[model samples]
Target: MEQAELTALLTAQGLRMVDEIGPLATTGEVAAAVSRLRGAGHSPDLVAAVVGQAHLRTRAAAKFGPFADRMLFTRAGLEQATRLEIAARHAARFRDAGLTRVADLGCGIGGDALGFAGIGLDVVAVDADETTAALAAYNLAPFGEAATVRHGLAEDVDLAGVDAVWLDPARRTAGHSETSRTRPEDWSPSLDWVFDLAARMPVGVKLGPGLDRGLIPDDVEAQWISVDGSTIELVLWSGALRRDGVRRSALVVRTGAAHEITAASDADDEPVRELGAFVHEPEGAVIRARLIGDVARELQAGMLGEGIAYLTSDAALTSPFVQSFRVREAMPLKVPTINAALRWNGIGTLEIKKRGVDVDPAQFRRKLTLKGDASATLILTRVGEGKAAQRLALLVDRV
Candidate 1:
């Protein structure tokens, strides 16, 4: 959002208008809003700001739910903001650790700050971008004295009286609408400085899930979290906030329930075996945290192929950490052979999942003339070792 647009949206009329209009979920609704607002003698800047925020709020509903109706967002800021439920879990860590005051550095639009304050903790939310900070202050206004937002660099923010720190370093270049990812060296406040402070005080750092494991500090607890099967973030916990004897953790939050699997370190991988009655795909968080071995043991399963993450077993049962598929039949990877089988089975709806192949599922789907009423999942993956390795297409049903 530009300064002029932001300025226009800060007025009494603008806020009321946005609240009344709610989310413009479609392009036609947005166009109608823009035309109507502009026709009513409203300035172009106000119309743009209102329309942009309305659309953004519609998109943000997936993350914030109904709370999105009252929030304001910039495209890039909303993209980086943590989900409200995820933020609450982060807040629970601080609360569970007996921390009361927190300094939220790089607080984008006060998402985490709201979480902190919602849990009755005092929060000092700071952001480098003036527009974002202003929006953060606005978003956090509901909390009144519990939340205090400041516009300043994270390194420059005073930490006096704060019990702990919450760091979300800016990982992208400066922008309101569009930004590109920055290298680790280019991160705001720098990881080196952040890690140094974390060593001296209690701190929780939110990072991208794909962060290099080698760079993680030895004393900190590294946790990967997945929401509805999508791996979302990796959080490094230090000092009193770090869970004891849990160096690596995978948290899976589905619906409103949360399940966790924690280990002191990555467990050993199970050996490869022949195809079994069922194949399980480890959840993204479990894969990222490298704790598939733990789940495999629980299900009495083994790797489907060497170095592959797929687990196979004849147990006819599965765990929450994996999506179990009952094997229907295994066929050659050739398109024609598979098409004949699919047609014979009357398969029309296909769900393609691949692990070690170069085939584009969309393009591959186009090659087959799907004309029946049945549905099945196709697993295109390489099985067996070295010279025996072959791309096998397995037809299966979700268990």
Candidate 2:
């Protein structure tokens, strides 16, 4: 949104219209609302901003939940903003560590800072983008004196008296929709600077889950979090915020329940074993944290193959760390062979999963015409080693 549109949206008149219009979820809904809004003598910019924000709130519901209804967002901000549930967890760490005064650097749309302020901490949130800072201030208005928003570079922010810092360095270039990923060195508040600050103070740095593990500092606790099945982020905690002896952590959150597995370092991979009754696919966070071996031990399972992440065991054991699937049949990884098996099993809907193999499930699905009501998950993978290795399809059911 332009500066003028934002100015208009900040007014009592503009926010009122947004609440009345509610969410314009569909393109058709947006068009009809835009036409009505324009016919009512609203300026083109105001109409555009209101309509766009309404649409975004509907989309943002997935991240912000009901809080989205009162919040304004840019396309990029909504995409990068931490989910409310995840943000709360970040806040709890600071509170538990007795760090009350917090600085949320690179505070996009006040997502994490809201978490801080909501917990009664004094939060000074800073954003490099002027518009984003304004929206953050607006979103955090309910907290009164507990929250402060500033439009400035994160590195320039004076951190004097701030007991703890939650640094979320901007990873994407500046834009609403056309932004691109920037190299780590290009990130605002460079990783080097962030790490230096982390060493001096209690700090929590939020980074992309896929960030290279080698770049992680040896002293900080690295926590990889996954919401549902998607690995969302990696958080590095330093100083007092770092839990004692917890170097690698995997936090899995499904619905509202959360489970965590922590270790001092990467756990050793268990030895490979023959395929058994149950095959387990570890959660993304577990794989990212390199804690697959810890989970494997808990389930009395071993690696399915030397390099593969899948685990197998005769026992049908399960845990929050992995999605357990019971093996039904195994066959050559050939289109005709799998197609015949699908037909024989009366399978119509198929969930094609592939690991350690080169195959496009969508394109490969075209070769098979499933015509029955049964549904099953087909895991295409390679088993064994060297010349003995062979590609095979394991038909399985969710346990």
Candidate 3:
């Protein structure tokens, strides 16, 4: 809805018209109210309210909150925010690099800005969207005078005295006219433009986790970040990317402890192996740090298949990155045996993970009859017996 009408409705309802509604209202009720406004063709303010509410509810409910307040709404465009730890890492990196004062150019909801301020660093968080700037203010409120939220274009913002700048361009393409997306390139200020700005000041560019490694600027430390097992974000650290593989690091953050995987050596090295009961998957940051082999060595596990991301162990080991499952049956790859085995187990839930297989999981599962209450993970791969084969890596649970 239009801001004027939305303001009026919020005033009438005594709602603050903030980033999201914290009331325990159901989505159906909110959707119905929004639908009524839409039916009247008045485009009520409840549209944003409903959207915001729905997003918050879904996000807060997820084991991992999907929303990152650091996501920016800059003049260039809107973009997703980075995870807290990832943002904090960047802030720490900049601080250690001697960047005393920094400008989060496209500071979205202030995710990274808060990280910077948390470390007692000087940060000027800038965003072009009024709504975003307001939200960022609330998110960064605890920082007090140490952090400031400004609504303006990055190029237009006065950042003369800052030693470093961080930017996350809006990466959504223009095709999102029918959706909520802005152009992907617009997510941050133009890269070329920002590059010019970075020539004078140190800069950090946050990009998609799946971004092409080739597109990474040579001078920037291109680092991919994965939290838990899920790869979340990639960071480009200009003035920090090192030839000796220094900037990239993989980290696994947990409730109790944190593990790290440093960058790989330039020399070709063998994978680490530990004869353990279970193999652990390294944290995403660890994997991105090119320390997967290092982790395997640390865990004393060996690779099961060539380029197989899974680590295998005969000993019971507790690690965050990999899950442990019993090799219940090592039968040859056959549909009849697979189907019979699955049906015998009453496989109600089937998780198919394959490294080198052409068969579709849906089709494979469809051919198998799963009955009663039971769950199992069916692994399909080329178990080279002169042919590719499928095996059931009976999963116990996420390690």
Tens digit of lDDT per residue, candidate 1, span 186-206? 999899999998999999999
Compute the lDDT of residue 349 as modeled in candidate 1. Answer: 92
TM-score of 1: 0.98
Off by over 4 Å in 1: none
State model 2's lDDT. Answer: 0.93
TM-score of each: 0.98, 0.99, 0.74
| RMSD (CA, Å), each prediction | 1.0, 0.9, 5.3
lDDT of 2 at 130: 94
Stretches off by above 4 angstroms in model 2 are none
Q: Give the TM-score of candidate 2.
A: 0.99
The lDDT for every candidate, in the order shown, is 0.92, 0.93, 0.59
Error of 1 at 111 (Å): 1.1
The weakest ten consecutive residues by lDDT in model 2 span 382-391
Candidate 3 residue 322 Cα shift, in angstroms, is 2.9
